[model samples]
Target: MFRRRPARELSADDLLTTLGRLTAQARAGAELQRARVELAEALQREMLPAALPGVPGVRAAAAYAPARNGLDIGGDWYDGFPLPGGRLAFCIGDVQGHDVEAAAFMGQIRMGLRAVAGGGADPGVVLARANELLLSVDSPLFATCTFLTFDPVAWEVVAARAGHPPGVWATADGRCGIAEENGGAPLGVLPGETYPVTYWRLAPRGAFALLTDGVVEGPSFPIEAGLAEAAKRVRDRAPTGDPADVAAAVMDVAEFTGHTDDAAVVVLCYDRADRDNG
Candidate 1:
């Protein structure tokens, strides 16, 4: 998408003809691609939580960007919902492939994970069940997901990572770090083993970012370098209007710099006043 630079000045007739053809071709291609993107994005959007559950003290926003120039769909997804006992569930995941089938499998995984986690399972238990569910189905697809439970009252979180990228945490005090969990192999590849959970406390008004590997792993750049660059940008960028905007901007930057993978992210920002004032 970024390869075609804007046309420059040329002699009048030739320029007009060339520009006209190019414009028509670009317009046609863009329209066709846009239609496909819209369809894929619609399908992908179905995987996200339709409405972020109303946590008394929290307001959240989220965004997803499929690959810009590819097959118009991807296998990354994010979801947030209310957990029992007034906690909130936040998660991001990705199936290995980027086709429609992968996307369909991705939707299944998203719903399955939420269902398993919604049943009061701990992060580890949730991942174990998810793995089992995927394996028993006889499908060859594999997915990586991270499950996070946020406690608004305590500003603490319990997270489980299953072959997914580590989450990013940006604190109210301006400190940021990757939330590392004991991630197991991707689901559907292994069965009968328990995934491990990690615990951490978010400083008041902290922002937690959960992302797919596409945010870091692409064909061009090393994953570590991409991650480092992304972390720096997320930390340095001024706090935006909403969590979704923050997440989208990060992905935008990554894609702008030529990362072609389908990137997806979910950002959770907690407000201290909401907990304290209550």
Candidate 2:
């Protein structure tokens, strides 16, 4: 009986051929998934601006850190461009989520802000228009952001925010203060909300820090604790030589353990005169 059953079974060659084809198909699927991930990452990197625009009487630099390991590039971004009145426009913002769609939405919001800001709109007006655009476009997504203007002649900087964390400002004597002002809800959150504008004068050699929540929100730490860490680094590394350096120091602290989210920061150090002459 056993001999008869064996004779009725398929040949070994046929079984091996079937197994080989199945393995090949599984490998092809894996390769395709990998290709998709790579494509997504490349697209994300392309979203960031190539270089920050030049601003009179200011040496500014910015840096962004993506997650330690993932397919997500990030939703955080910074932009520097000239305003209509010879003033400079600088902005930083972060979308609520991290994904391809979120990044696309971020690009749309950024372009809209630029269009409004380019028209010499104040920070408050810029935020309001941005909110309206988000709602009208039906691209409803929450975002925290700050818009700022720097006037070299007046040595002044005006800022406005929408549910973004307060920026950091440090005096010449090593004293640092958080820039807290009344703000409206984040964009695409609730329409018809108003964001108040705030003003501050930049002392010669003053340092200002604008950061995204990715730097503060973490697993083992709260926002306050993370802010404290940034302060300590700033104090210890007093008079950070450049904006990029300060950004790196902050990232070093947050990434000491690992990157939780996309960390982006803009550091502006006001010097009495341009370094190019020196």
Candidate 3:
């Protein structure tokens, strides 16, 4: 058997070399993570609507902000479009988790909702059908969503929710309150859940808002408090302005700085002038 020589201890030079290599590896890993986050942000932006639809009897506006930490991408999304029967559909949703996968799932659910609504289904039916579609896909993620179909001709709005936050309703004279309704389980949670629809008369020159949790829930504030604060903000700013301006004003009150969750909002204003023109 050959005799083995004694092992020599690592010198400072050797240690320095090893540390340099480790540092380089860490830097490379961080760079790769940053690239992935950028890609996810871009993908999320691509999935959102470029502009909210302008219906004859309603003025609509939407705003979206991604997370400020980690991947900087979350499953918060908003959509508004005119349906076939001259009704306008507005939706806001937040999928579980903050990642690219959640965002992708959100896109699928939103498209499915639009398809079902286009078939002239009511808000409740649209959500029910969308839930079935998600189950068929076997999606592991679940989401909270609120859908509303506004019929300008009838001056009514039909609304449905799937574990989403209550919508804020404001009268033309600046009075505001939350419209609480019974909601079913979130989509992808139960195979056959029934969504209930609530009908409300649209107030002249009034507006309704759909928002994700990120807009209301924060570190220091509870959900109820946030809703109250938001309602006040809406009441103050919604008296006169375009939908877009109102949306911006409401979001400004949310104070998103240092918040971890993403936010999305959609404001639909029923101006008497628009109805008269239609």
Candidate 4:
């Protein structure tokens, strides 16, 4: 109870101990930050498939490149899910940012697409519903996208674009061109925007590619030139190349562009079911 013991004098050893503790804390904090970044990147990467879904007469392949100029993950995503009547819905989009928040928004948008697309609905309606879902979320981030339903049985395509670059297509005879950008505003931007439906026919051994702007746009390279070059490369590979190889060809367009953003490509190649059987 007594007189308080004299305050412990600040000795060199005591100072050293305190400094060591602070250093350790700082190191631990840095490590924690690194871990969090890694986790976010992994989750974002996992959201997009490493191997796209496969169906009879339709082979899908994808290639992804994260942003080379930043450590944080960017928000480019693509997926293929089964639809009713042996059809499949494929989407590729770029959410606006290179951070964890963008990735989270991307996840929500993808889930909404899958949920609304279950009935094999028209592509325009599907996009409109998805836009509502995105708008309802408490986020400022918006996305540009192309959504489409492909019927492997009919070799038909019904697609809708939302303020995004038009997709590219190549027939078996080496004819290739880009789609018309008849798109509405990007998702989560304007309320009640309408996405127009566009029809396309896929010939046997033909291919369609959905890609983000990163694959064809750069500071020094114009998208127009890049797209033309991409079409040529894709047409060169679409006839006999595997979907993976063809997807790479699409990505290769950025080589001259020197693109620094994240890039993603999903290629859908169509072949007659009877081709292998015959």
Task: Give a tens-digit lDDT track for model 3, residues 137-200.
Answer: 9878999999998887888989999999998878778689998988899988997899999999
lDDT of each candidate versus the true structure: 0.75, 0.76, 0.83, 0.85
Global Cα lDDT for candidate 2: 0.76
Candidate 2 stretches with Cα past 4 Å from truth are 1-36, 236-240, 256-258, 275-278
Model 3 misplaced stretches (Cα beyond 4 Å): 1-8, 256-258
Worst 10 residues of 1 by lDDT: 232-241
Error of 4 at 90 (Å): 0.5
lDDT of 4 at 134: 90
The alpha-carbon RMSD values of the candidates against the true structure, listed in the order shown, are 9.9, 4.5, 2.6, 5.7
Off by over 4 Å in 4: 1-33, 273-278
Look at candidate 3 and tell me the lDDT of residue 170: 84
lDDT of 1 by residue, 1-278 (tens): 56888887678998799899999999999888777667666777776677666475566666666676666577888788888888888878888776666777888888788889878988889989989999988888998888888888777889988888887767566676666667888889987977888888666565777777777766776766766656665665425426766676667656745767677777776777766787
Per-residue lDDT of 48 in model 1: 68
Give per-residue CA lDDT, model 4, range 13-68, as digits (tens): 99999999999999999888678678769779768766777676778898888888
Residue 42, candidate 4: how far off, in angstroms? Answer: 1.6
lDDT of 2 at 23: 99
Which of the two, 2 or 4, has more TM-score?
4
User: Candidate 3 has what TM-score?
Assistant: 0.92
Candidate 4 total steric clashes: 0
Model 4 residue 262 CA deviation in Å: 0.2
Best of the candidates, lDDT: 4
| Cα error, candidate 3, residue 198 (Å) | 0.6
